[model samples]
Target: MTTVAFVLAGIAALIHVYIFRLESLAWTDPKTRAVFGTTAETAEVTKPLAYNQGFYNLFLAIIAVIGIAVGAFGSASSDDVSTALIHAACGSMVAAALVLATSDSSKLRGAVIQGVAPALAILALLLS
Candidate 1:
């Protein structure tokens, strides 16, 4: 159960890292813009907002990674703390996805891509 939880959460972290790169470093790049279906001009106009949003994704990834590390190696007394961290990080991911879906049904696929692994990790942790 622990391994499953870790693996799923790690995947979620990696996904967010990719999102960070796309949003922060490549938002105006043609290929990145295509991935996001944004015109170059639109990308340029929204660059600052995307850059800021990218940091939010990075911070969530950091929290998830820290939770994984603590769950794997911290003292026994830290179990509750580790679990809480993991839940908070994963919960935020799920919440963000839900918001995206609610904002625009067209974004449902993106929402699922962003949220599924973390949702699974949370479920695995709870069932364990």
Candidate 2:
């Protein structure tokens, strides 16, 4: 269960890192615009906001990755801290997805994409 949790969290972290790239590095790119369903003008106008939001995603992913690493390789004394980090990071991801899904019905698919792996990781961690 612990391994499963770490693997799922790793996947969620990777997904967020990809999201960060799309949002921060390529927000105005045609492909990214298409993925986000945004017009060029809107993308341009929202670029700053997206850039900042992308960092938030990146930070969450970092926290999860760090937690996975600590849990896997850190000293026994650090186990509780690693667990807390994982829960905090993945919980934030799930909460953000829930907010997005509730705020806009059309974004449900995106919400699921954003949330599922982290949610599963949390569940597996609990079972572990």
Judging by TM-score against the true structure, name the best candidate: 2
Model 2 pairs in collision: none
Q: Clashes in each model (backbone N, CA, C under 3 Å)?
A: 0, 0
Model 2: worst 10 consecutive residues (lDDT sum): 76-85
**Error of model 2, residue 111, in angstroms:** 0.4
Q: What is the C-alpha lDDT profile of model 1 across 30-52, one tens digit per residue?
A: 99988788998999999999999
**Model 1: runs farther than 4 Å from truth?**
none
Residue 123 error, candidate 1, Å: 0.4
- Cα RMSD for candidates in order: 0.8, 0.6
Model 2 lDDT per residue over 1-128, tens place: 99999999999999999999999999999999998889999999999999999999999999999999999999989889889999999999999999999999988999999999999999999999
Off by over 4 Å in 2: none
Model 2, CA-based lDDT:
0.96
